[model samples]
Target: MAQQLAQGGLTGAAKLKAVTDLINSLTQDLSTSSLGPRERDAALDELKVYARDPRNADPIFVKEGIETLSKHAFDGSSATTSRNALRCLANCLLVKPSTRNIFVDLGYPEKASIKLTTAGVEDEFLISRIIFLTTYGTSVNLQNLIDQHHLADAILQNLTRHVKLWTGSSGSSFKAASQDPMTDMALTETAKLLFNVTHFCRQKVDSFTPAIALIVTLICQHALPQPKPLDPPLGSLVNALLTLNLASEQGAAALFPKANPAALCERLIQVLDKAVRSYPDRELDTAVLPLITALRKIYELAPAEGVQRVMQAKLLPTTKDRKKVLGKGQSLASLILRHTTNAMAPEFSKAVSHMLFELSDKDATKFVQNVGYGFASGFLFQNNVPVPESVQESFQASEGGRQRAVNAITGQFIDKETAPELPEMTDEEKEREAERLFVLFERLKSTGVMNVENPVARAAREGHLGRDVIDGKDRVEELD
Candidate 1:
């Protein structure tokens, strides 16, 4: 019957008549109590095809057409028939969101959410999407899905099932992808729906805690290369996690267990490294923030061993690169730091800066010492954080008293023999340089960057600035 529209070149009134006749006929057959098994499946399939085309879809919604589709979708006829019915409903909802209310008033969302609890991969994909669509213009209450129908439980269960199916007992690539492509599509649709549910009902995120650890393990176990910034499961997993409180007591337990405290974080660091390498600068501006934020949150609550592992991750500056300038190579830490200074991606840069700062425990001293004053000062100066005098005279060792062979300010190891040498300044040049320094300090003080004393002005006040006036009648505060 659908071939009549295409093969016969039915046009104008002829096409409309043919489509109307097909839909009405299918609707009648599908609604029939005595319809045979094969006839019901064929009718459902034809209705699905009819609903797919916008022009021919009006009759599907004409008179109780959606009602008929909704009945068969979960009417306990047969799995194939139910899935076919679901496709028809999926198409109608996609093409005309206005009919969402029509479907909702029929009370299928509640039924759909329940179906999700036991649905297979295909049904899971279809039902989750159908319920997710009701969230748009319809008056569907997402919290009701959480509080009333236990939708979060279903999402987590499906994610666990996907994990087992994709990776099996061994740590490897998603084997299900080669045998079947629906596995990938199933995850994408399911994740989108999960993001919606959690976004609308944030207070209920505890319901999703178990899935977080599973996602982390899945990401870690995938041995294949992370070839893109937002591949399936990676991007989807991050999206589900973005709203979750990975820092909560429950969340913390799942991530940093006692057996191997830093295992998950170290694994996530590897994932972040791949993302840094895969993402273009424009993509980096938005695609990678959640991953960065997730790592930061976990690190903030990580144990000592975990912290050490995270600091030693490729995302942070290392002494091995202290021979050259920081943020200057294709290494993971360098690429991440390169983004920290990117002007096009200010928020991305800020997140990168925050991640680095957290790795240093947010200490002003460690911040400057680890990344050098040049990098740390930019972050500090941009956010109006006043630098203490101690951060200026950077320490050469970490808190554990491990000394490093790196310049405090430049973050580079100086080979004095090969270092570029310039001539010493003459007396006049020295005086001119002092004057310039005075002017620069004065400007900095004026701008409120720091409430610092102008040493040159203080020198002049105490008569120590080229005036032989160190002797004062009223005692001036001595310069240190």
Candidate 2:
């Protein structure tokens, strides 16, 4: 039968029909009481061979194959057979997008999702393939997965479980083992599937915040480090970052709030910096653009405190010497400016400029001083690609625009206007307060309350030490 299916001179329709008949027969055999597990396994193997053919993507055949495979998939009789069935379905879905609906219609989504929970490496791979394929269709298709099969939740659960398993009790173990090529590849595909789901179903992604956080944490934990000679892989890390960027763009900023923005900014800068250092001459525009975009999104969506934290982090080169060499001692601002000036791709430069513009909006004088006015004017110059008008205006308006330019040209750290000083306690006042505290401590000590040992006594001491200990006791008595 296999020979006949592989034989030449058969029409596509004829081949599909033959494969369909083979699948039907296999399903019948598996259903029979007389067949042993070995026989059933053999039939499933045969089904896998034919079902994987691109010609077998006809909707009717796909539906029939899915129904048969889904039965065995959920039966738990044999992992190998179930996995083969999943592989066949995945292959068909991959070849034909139309089969995705058929897959959902035949209740395969729910079954596939259930399998995802307990799937081993190979089975998980196949199941992920199916989910990834489904993601290629329209948003409506994604909605079906979310609404009917709860695919979003399932994938999140699967990712969380696998990541936990991979990371073990201490996440460092997973990072250490991430260098295994096969494990890395599997995880990469998983991350890709996650990216697709999140990208297609933005409105629904919020509910999966825990899963999103886990993925971000995993990426930040494992990928932020400089790539080892034998790191797990970069694909998952890249995809995870892309997913985060997409989610943030779609108004999901909650996940990033707790992530140390300063550390995150430093990590992103490190990725771009390392890439540029490695390939000094080549155009890494495509490779580094996503990182830059992700950085931009972080700045746009992060809370004020988070954004301030990132701004305070040392992200750019501080010294002119380092800028000349394109060497170490670089700050985030310097990196952005240098890349803006020298980027081979206009889009890359634009991304960096937009980030700079945003930072300028946050503090125009600081941006002007940090990158220097000459570099700032050139970056904000409206030649071919223009900076936001507001950015240009902000620079012009900063320090009435004149002093900032002069200060930038002269390399002066002087600010024309100083921030208002906060009120401070003088030494005399400090000494007086200290003396009062000492007297209060002595009084409390004499009363056998040198420390805050009891809640009532602590409350009384804290409340009354400023007054008299007797008054504190009276207040405590009134409360009692």
- Please give each candidate's TM-score: 0.76, 0.62
Segments in model 1 whose C-alpha atoms lie over 4 Å from true places: 1-15, 33-36, 46-56, 61-63, 166-178, 223-226, 305-309, 390-405, 416-480
Question: Model 1, range 166-188, lDDT digits (tens) per residue?
Answer: 66743534664535767666877
Q: Which candidate is the best by lDDT?
A: 1
lDDT of 2 by residue, 1-480 (tens): 543545333436776675666576657755684456677677666655655555543532456766776677666477776776676677667666777877776666666766676666666678877877766653336666667766767666666755675567535467555555555556666777777777777776655555655665555555433542113334355555565433443335434544454555555556666655554434546556666677776666666666645653545334432223222235544555677666476777777766766665545455554555556666545633443334322232233233332234323333432455756656565456546655665576568634423323444467543234322332322121
Q: Weakest 10 consecutive residues, lDDT, candidate 1? A: 467-476
TM-score computed on alpha carbons, candidate 2: 0.62
Best by TM-score: 1
Instruction: Provide the lDDT at 123 for model 1.
Output: 92
